[model samples]
Target: MTQPEPLPSAAATPAPAEPPSRPSLPSLPGLPDLPDSHVDAVELSGPRFQTEPAQVYRELRQRHGPVAPVLLHGGVPAWLVLGYREVLQVTQDAALFSRDSSLWRLWSAIPEDWPLRPLIGEKQESILFTVGEVHRKRADAVNEALFGIDPFALRDRSERIADTLIDGFCERGSSDLIAEYARLLPALVLAYFFGFSDSEADEVTHSINDMMDGAETAVESQAAFYTACRELVAAKREHPGADATSRLISRSPTGSEEEIVQDLMVMFAAAHQPTAEWIGNTLRLMLTDERFALSLSGGRRSVGWAMNEVLWEDTPSQNVAGRWPTRDTVLGGQRLHAGDLLVLGFAAANTDPQVRPDPAVSTQGNSAFLSFGHGEHGCPMTGRESAETIARAGIEALLDRLPDVDLAVPAQDLLWRPSPWMRGLSALPVRFTPGPRTLG
Candidate 1:
């Protein structure tokens, strides 16, 4: 059987170029549009992403020549950078492409019901939207906190959590892997790091996932998230622990409780769903691709190898939005004006013929694509290691327990959540021989 091939054959080849873009169209534009917003912007959030992002990314690549236009949450216009080298140019050259959302042109024009307001608004205190000195200050604290994490201990905790979660369904012989395993493992692990009780992990994940869905409840979910983080911060301050959150509280430069709370919130919010979804994506590979499955489960290939493949092909965030241009610039022959918002097409860039060219071989670093982001805004020291370890140990425990696990439903029937920026399976139902539960 053919290996996953890093998301279909198109990933190994350059996306076919489309006919010239047509400007002045009322709806999303065709491929021929040139020079940044010359044609209408395509909608980034929709069924298209939920179904096939690689296919959609290839189409977008063909359509606008890599740096094209896309409408964000609430019909906001922005450039979607699809080329690998172009993504590198935008993310690495922070001088030209700033993370500061203030430069985002649509911030002021967006409607009150703007769906991504929490993610992009200035009121959101996550370091993701900061730039320059402010970002450095935040990153410093985060980096230190991440450094304090004990990976060995973290891995052990993750395995135990995975075993616990599997016990909830192993006896039934059928389960939605996404909800029961992939999604829960990271949440519980993160709750430990954030110094919350394991029992609270489900609620933490539910709130973050709700925010990711951007439903009517999302606003209220985020507000509740704030309150939880604030409480966690106070508890950590009053009675410190060795967890990552306590480290963050001690290292944070801010005296304001609000700033401290934002730091903790971003840690849990940023780390949970995206990490969980990507873990789900990796599990999908194990279930669908026989060669990949055998290699991973048989110990010939490590989970890290499979994970890199997932990041290359089925990254959690297909199109991470909102990198505003700091000045008028030209990227891939596309003219980008100052404050022109740009979305980094991580999946598309990973497949760019100029970058990967051959999925059969592995790319050595995270910088190979924007999966973990780049430059000042990249994930912290223990971030990648901690995440990979958790995913690996959790999956390993399950595979050890249920080597015959396979999809309970057809792969095509599985659906992903519909969000403009991220890609994640809504549920992954699986069936395995009924087995005794793992003991505590």
Candidate 2:
């Protein structure tokens, strides 16, 4: 059996080279002047962020045209590659662009020896963390695991859990979607995969959120989260249950208990966190777009398309996959040193106009979007039957039970989680009509 062709290298590829002397951040060419149309000024920080990103995205396209360099949080310099082709180039070329977070050490306050450094190692980093052959091999392994799970069984279990939560909330009339429903739903699914009891799952979910909160104080909180994950893995091994944890522990090449625990922790972090945000964002999008919500409720054939549209429009992950510059390279016309951090802004890339001519359309072909990322380090977990099954099941369950659910509070009244790396509402209060009861 022959191996596949290796992904392109960042250094070897021919392109306009960055001059020997590093140039100052180049001015974005072809940007249009800010529009004179009467429109509400939307701030991109604080409470405004939830509503502002899409508007800013549209405004940037209108004012600066596509491919403008926008100032992100803390005024970090980042090129917003809004052109579809440009964004795809950045996303698809692993050699020219990197996803290693360590490259941005100077920009972040975290210490150099942070434990996360090992988790996202020089090679087998998270699915979104590496490039080249090393990235390809690891990605294949993770994808196999992710997709190997039975989707129907997973969805059946998820539906039961979602129904149970909805039943509990329906009696109470109004519920905080984030704390009561959305948070618990993903955590339960994750726990089930880890072979954890419902109670243990809830605890781990809370702990994960706490650790994320302490990311600025990451060393301590991450240590705590890892400790919990290790304990769970140990228990799963002893019990030998039918969940992902047991499977991974039994099959992992790194059979050491500690190594198994570390792998599980990495998977847990990647799977649960962003999923929670996706659920919350989906709810928020439904609230804001009544027509879209109506489409879902009215049984319009476009629910799948609408879901994709929502995913693209409100990307849950704010950080693009980070990569380390293996050698000197140039991206978006900016020269990067060998060790520079290259962030492929997935959110910015997803909204790029060149690839997605109409941001409103949900059914655009797969190659145009970056919600799941691209290239060797791109999210290999995507297109896995298991994830698709889960998504289909979750969406179906949501449509069946709470089709018309909308935010109980005004859009501005909602609270967003503060982590720039993740975008999920901290609490989404919503009102919905109760679904018919199901007997156990």
Candidate 3:
């Protein structure tokens, strides 16, 4: 089928009066240059949506200037919208740009009843994937449920969990930080949020890890997680607990055991991977950058800065947000037909010079980084207040309990997650002098 036509307004926006300032293109450390051999292949297939799209994106920006059409994932036609202004416009204008992926013809191949549909499809209530009013409402509820709880109330319990994991590693002198520590912490927190008991929390964590390793998409893993969530919600209904999941279930309009369970699964699936990557990336940054590590060691407040820097320098989700053109619109001086898919390259946009003054300093928490995104659809959870609260507390506890922590292996030897959508170290082995267990 012919790709959807670009809405009329797609061609109406005038190009900016002045060119955006951006750093001169830099060669990737180790990658082949685009060949004339694949020019036709590329156009037919669309932009390659692989682990190293950054190189292709940089090349497109240089060759096409700002706005250019490129194929994505082999054959899907999409506008590789680069430059700060264009990206900002596309991300902010909900009317012009729609985040609904269902409109795209590419996803039509998947059956409507596919398990992954609620997680990645274009349907309303697909919190992370849908767009328009439905996206707004469900997203608001999810955010409220996720962040609405007082993380401080659980600080004591969280610290105990963090310390117990750290102690196990300090004794061994080396452990896979990602698999053992970073991954475990968030799952435990999420379990508490879902009102699972401590032992039940361990079970949920194991189930989540298994599901992540086993399934390629959110739908593939939903059945197992949904089952666990359903059990927990049923228990909460009988004996209302103090956890966030229970609280949300209590107040929800759709408080049936099934709906509550499904929503929890959606929330956990959306949050688990991203948060795990964040923790893994944060540890990697501290271990590699002595200057950054020193800053964290010197003051507890610096953790927020460090987290922001990591978000920019090591963007976890390369393709977190997407939009389809609602009407004809011009982004980066390229006309977009209605139904055309516009994938926001947070990785590319975060490093753009026009939007960020020193793209390289993204590691330094420059205010301009688009890590959390921008406009109405931007990640509302990021900002000074939340960052200070979460990072400071976690880092302070870590430093107080494990002051001499150092990587056991060379930084270059670390393995990174293979997905382009998220950047994270697969494992972090470290040795630290153990301190007296003061809290746990």
Candidate 4:
């Protein structure tokens, strides 16, 4: 729950005291290393994400080089990998940075009620926890379901859904973009694809919200999520349709109901938040940045350009948890335990000087950013219906239709959710001239 990076403090008084720059932890003989329990629990929504993450990350980079130690929600210590090349080296090397829970040192120490349980905890065996052959087998079924979808066609359907959602608010000349458009579209799309009815989709979205937001009832919501997914899977199995759930169930090598349900749950859970945040953040970028607004609106710039820039500058998921070292190793001049937990700072790495001295160049292509990550454990949304395609399509639907759309409030006033793991807005109130329903 710590900030991605802590920034230099702002002194409101006459003078500001300089925080002693501790660049690297001392690994001297007989000197005790910093304990994970000692690191502060500064949640993302706790005034850090809005005002401090970038600066905090910058300070860590200046001090530690690339990877630095930080405390997760439960006083669980882990290394936050902040360098671009360093992140690539760690994530790409499966033998070194294993994703298997067997290598996670801090998981056992974490208390049951830890607030980040929903984000970091996995009660059931899913693709996120396994590695090697296990991951390959489980991933094949999930990938067949995910990569099988057509992105261009999915975009068309998502656009139609976006239009319907907009129609609800178009008359008022104002809307909460996050709630009405960004969030709802994916829920509806995923629900339809998984064979859930409209009412079920609404409830599924509710459970998904509770789970993703780490609400106090998250664990309960996760249970409810499992139940809903099982029902969906069961129905699909009995009546086998063209939906992803049906495909996943039929293709699964294990042929186990529990495993099938877990995989289905993972697919929905993974897609919901990241995809929504990408749309919301990308829209926020297009609206707030005048150059972006003008260029994209006028067709002088491409949606692909805006999407790439947002992916690099403000990654939808700032912190990716659960990358552990398979053996004792030295990272960023600090010694790591064999099974120590480490975080991948996707946003920080995207900004690492070694990767891109000028972030604006991110729009130019090359696609080296770790936001989608790489290697065997990379994002499953790799094919056409990827975040990039969905976001571009969704953004086009809104901007192309509502060109006058602008922030209803000052950009500075917009709020960001406090969960340290995600980079998302609480709401995006937008106002545009009343537009007609795009749907017939």
- In the order shown, what is each candidate's alpha-carbon RMSD? 5.3, 10.7, 8.7, 4.8
Candidate 3: lDDT over CA atoms?
A: 0.61
Stretches of model 4 off by over 4 angstroms after superposition? 1-45, 295-301, 360-362, 381-384
Instruction: Estimate TM-scores for all models.
Output: 0.88, 0.74, 0.77, 0.88
Candidate 4, residues 96-186, lDDT tens digits: the string is 8898766666555556656555455447477788888888898899988876676666777777777888788888889999988888878
Ten-residue region with minimum lDDT total, candidate 1: 1-10
Q: Residues 1-440, candidate 2: write the lDDT tens digits.
A: 22212212223234223321111222123322322221211112343344455544554445434444433332223444445455567666655556655455333433354333443354443445544665555555455556556776788888888777777777555778777766667667767766777777777777777766655655565676677778887887778777777777666654667656766776777777667677667766666766566756674344555556656766776645355555776555545456544444567667765666665554534434567665565555533344445545555676677767767888878777754356778788877776565644
Per-residue lDDT of 187 in model 2? 64
Candidate 2: residue 285 lDDT (0-100) = 68
Cα error, residue 439 of model 4, in Å, equals 3.3
> Residue 86, candidate 1: how far off, in angstroms?
1.7
Q: Between candidates 1 and 2, which one is better according to lDDT?
A: 1
Residue pairs that clash (backbone atoms under 3 angstroms), model 1 = 20-32, 21-32, 21-33, 31-63
Give candidate 3's total backbone clashes: 22
219-303: candidate 1 lDDT, tens digit per residue: 7888877777888888888999988888888887775687778777777767777788878988887888765778544753556
Put the candidates in lDDT order, highest first: 4, 1, 3, 2
